[model samples]
Target: MPRIDWRSDSGSAVAEFSMVAGLLTLLTLAVVQLGLGLLVRNTVLDAAAEGARHAALADSSLPAGEQLTKQLIATAIGEQYAADVSASYGTWHGQPCTQITVTTTLPLIGLIGVQHGLEVTGHAAREVLD
Candidate 1:
């Protein structure tokens, strides 16, 4: 600290600014990624719920629910998210019900991501007539 050469600071400002800008860019991307993930998740969940309700009808079948779920997801998001969709009959709270499940990948980059990144299910009681 005896003698500081001010000339040595040449280009220091630019270097520091570059680093900070990179960090800020990364942070922004992270936030955007999180939002995208949530959006995909919610969309898939809604599709599953719709499928479950459709299948729960007295006249509906499990395959119908699965198809509905896939269609919903395909329409809302894309065909990729609609993959691996399935429907099954089950009992919920001691009542017969239809369950729809969707398995899809998270969007790592614009709806393209790892396989089976997330799985979600929906259930609806069967509509019975007296």
Candidate 2:
């Protein structure tokens, strides 16, 4: 019978690294997902503002205004993300104003059967002379 000593095995370091790598990978993915969601929120707000400004023009008819708003939202947020989005026209301080409400669901990484759905609203007033 021969005695073997395993105290000097170098494979344990590799095994430890492998376990840490999985956790690190998950953390990285979660961060990326959250950052993307914030980016989308900002983009949606900007698009809403642009649409509202365009609609505020006196030359833009009601239907045209609505269409332009929708087009702007669609262009910025993909059709999937813009689903169920709604916009409304109103008057503020005797000037036309547009309000856009955007809604979308963000994917949750490493989370099972869980999702974060958020609604972000943006309002823009027309630069009309009182």
Candidate 3:
């Protein structure tokens, strides 16, 4: 057999490892980012729904619901995500309802993203006295 050239392949393993490691790092970061985005979205949606249910009570008002939503968001994530919260009266399935809307940023790179990139709304039937 002809003499093999080991020197030519000496750094090939390192180069291949570097490329694969970089790709794996990027993939891991992407998965983490996706998870964080989903967590934020679910938290915001839950907060909105809780706020709407609270406002649907007979003694609660739209402003109170908005405040609760803001507080929930601020407590869970940050004050920035609670910046744009609103509550309104509406009808769902012919029944009076309270609606809470939360508009916030969609996290792209570590909680930094385009403004108003995500919007979620929650509703609950209003409580009325006969």
TM-score of each: 0.86, 0.71, 0.92
In terms of lDDT, which candidate is stronger, 2 or 3?
3
- Which candidate number has the best lDDT? 3
- Per-model CA lDDT versus the true structure: 0.89, 0.64, 0.96
**Where in model 2 is the C-alpha error above 4 Å?**
4-9, 90-96, 109-116, 127-130
Better of 1 and 3 by lDDT: 3
Query: Which run of 10 residues does model 1 get worst, by summed lDDT?
Result: 106-115
Span of ten consecutive residues with least summed lDDT in model 3:
4-13
Error of 3 at 124 (Å): 0.7
Q: Candidate 3 on 1-130: residue-level lDDT in tens?
A: 8997976767689899999999999999999999999999999999999999999999988999999999999999999999999999999889999999999999999999979999999999999989
C-alpha positional error of residue 100 in candidate 2 after TM-score superposition, expressed in Å? 1.6
Q: What is the alpha-carbon lDDT for the whole of candidate 3?
A: 0.96
* Ranking of candidates on TM-score, top first: 3, 1, 2
Clashing pairs in 1: none
lDDT per residue for candidate 1 within 1-130, as digits (tens), equals 5987887977799999999999999999989988999999999999899999998888888899999899888998888789799888889889888889888997887667888989999999888878
